[model samples]
Target: MRSTFSSRLRRHALLGFLAIDMLGLVALVVDQVFSTDPVYPWIIAMGLVIAALPLLAQAVDYVLSTPADAAIVPDTGEKIP
Candidate 1:
């Protein structure tokens, strides 16, 4: 059970990393193509930051919601028998 949880966590982390990297690449391309003025770099930076916000929120929620032990907890606010 622990191994399965760890494997799932690793997969989630990898997916998050890929998502951030892809967002950065897309922002870079957009800045290079659309913005003609000197503000392009700042635009790219802002875009990346905005894209990362949701991932950051999810990570925080995961940390907060996970218990010290390995028991699965449902988010429905009801105790399971």
Candidate 2:
């Protein structure tokens, strides 16, 4: 993959995880404040699944990506080779 594309994917993945985390935190607050509501726990559980998608995608990308594709470090935007 191109360095710019790889970096974009990483950034989007991080954003996706951040969104799920924020939602989970909000759900936790709701669950605590409204103990009678049973939906919050389910929402929190769903958030867990949503959060795992990026990890799963990364795992697949790692397994299938070429060495050249991995040469570019997204964090530093540097090509190792």
Number of the top TM-score candidate? 2
TM-scores for all candidates? Answer: 0.45, 0.45
What are the lDDT figures for the candidates, one per model? 0.68, 0.67
After aligning candidate 2 to the native by TM-score, how far in Å is the CA of 78 from where it should be? 15
* Residue pairs clashing, model 1: none
Runs in model 1 deviating more than 4 A are 36-81
RMSD of each: 7.8, 10.3
lDDT for model 2, on a 0 to 1 scale? 0.67
Specify the highest-lDDT model's number.
Answer: 1
Candidate 1 lDDT, 1-81, residue by residue in tens: 998898678766765665666667766777677766656755676677677767765764576455866566655777888
